[model samples]
Target: WNYQFLTQLGYPSNYYAAGEMTVSQHLEVSGQPDPYNPGWVGLDYIFGSGMRGGSSGGPHIANLGEIVDSATDPGQFPDRNTIFAVTSWGYGLGNSSGTEIKIQGASPLSGVANANNFVDLFNAACRRSRAHFGTWTCDLLVP
Candidate 1:
């Protein structure tokens, strides 16, 4: 799904790099539910090279790069934020590559009074299932 849904739920999207500049990267989201918290859903993708080392995990450990918000309140949504960690493999690295996206909040999801409300909104949107690529996800995060 696109970040628009996340923004609709009041979440910000952050980006990061995984390894060297040569490695290609992207984001993926599935309607997977969080096994640890059924009340919460999950979106997972490989971050950087799952291979480890050789510029693995990129230059930053916690890359909270940017934030995008809706133009309007959009009604009944909590203020949530998403942080992404990305990694890549150099040319000819073979199958030595992977990438990941991590969605966290500036504050704990449970701490936000509107947390459940936003989750409900996200679930409603997920029924339609929208996926995007490149930096386009950034636009989706804002209105």
Candidate 2:
């Protein structure tokens, strides 16, 4: 999911938009240094999207669809509709004709460098939420 504003729309309009994108690829991008800041390491998934701005930091959900029963389709993990990433950035070309083709990216929730750290952070957030809301239901499914 993303909230993007078409650059052509110009400012003053204050017309921001929201939309969803299909995961064209679940990339395992690791060990890459940030081009802008060499000291930082990068890990993310790159996918296709339209040419609009302000989509960064949106949640990228996984298993986002109707659930099938285990009896009908066994060997399925219990986690469904889980957000596994957030929109990081997008890059591509655009023309004056307003036909823009761009690709976006996000850092995956797991299976990369510092994955354990990510898990810890998630669990910490869950714990904080549980405490703040006075509910014991906030928990992370850490495999």
Candidate 3:
């Protein structure tokens, strides 16, 4: 994460850590309507890490950084946008919301494609700015 974005999220800067996902989950849309992939669909990848707190609708960035900027609304810094996945459920619910954040199942390709569409629209709407944010209204961004 960039120090500018970090600070904007109300966190102290100077922190840089990376994690490698060690798991992959496959699923079926038997009882559901699959958008990304029709029947017998498979998800990209699912991961688990130790995150205490973060915004629910924030973006999930890849190590490469700035895959697609999605936060383009007011109060959101388009220049600091770098999203690969839409932040989904987490592990601090009953006790906070949940910390087991995972990338949207549509990410890898389908999800990213959908997000790209939004990004494009966002850029057009925000004068060539990202449409999503890693921490738009986040309360905290610390380890």
Candidate 4:
């Protein structure tokens, strides 16, 4: 988890204040609705993390590794550093006194079966960028 300020009661402080956690659960496209907060939806992946505040929009990347621009082999899945989701919300298992177990969540960036996918969104942004700049700026990264 990435945050600017560490507000959790028992959480420690460090430079950059960033940490990574393994995702435990992945909710489906249907998502979970909160009864406590009306019209609020929770369609995200759950993981164990101590990050509390100022980390809402951090990226949740999958297959993260070194950028291998190999001379022999281009390597498998060029988009290995792709961000699958972004941090949404989290909570701790305790009361106002203190927290015991910390858990975090992030909503997926794209679902394979979804009508409006990440590719569409990315393309739209690229188109808009080209329209304004008279050149395809995104082509350098994607193409």
Q: Model 2 off-target regions past 4 Å?
A: 1-43, 65-71, 74-78, 94-99, 132-136, 141-143
Candidate 4 collision pairs = 1-19
What lDDT would candidate 3 get against the real structure? Answer: 0.33
Q: lDDT tens digits, residues 1-143, model 3? A: 11111211111111222122222222211123334456644333333333323323334443323445475553544434344343343332234354434323223222433654564454454542333543343322121
Query: If scored against the real structure, what TM-score would every candidate get?
Result: 0.21, 0.54, 0.30, 0.49
Candidate 2: clashing pairs of residues: none
Model 3 spans with C-alpha error above 4 angstroms = 1-45, 52-55, 64-81, 90-116, 126-143
Q: What's model 3's TM-score? A: 0.30
Give per-residue CA lDDT, model 2, range 54-114, as digits (tens).
5565566555567756575544444555666666666666786868666666666665655
Q: Which parts of model 1 have CA positions greater than 4 angstroms off?
A: 1-19, 43-143
Quickly count the clashes in candidate 3: 16
Cα lDDT listed for each candidate = 0.33, 0.54, 0.33, 0.54
Weakest 10 consecutive residues of candidate 3 by summed lDDT? 3-12
Query: Rank order by TM-score, top first?
Result: 2, 4, 3, 1
The candidate 2 region of ten consecutive residues with least summed lDDT is: 5-14
Estimate, for each residue in 32-100, the C-alpha lDDT of model 4 and write its tens digit.
Answer: 555357887655556667556666776765445676564776545455556666777777786777657
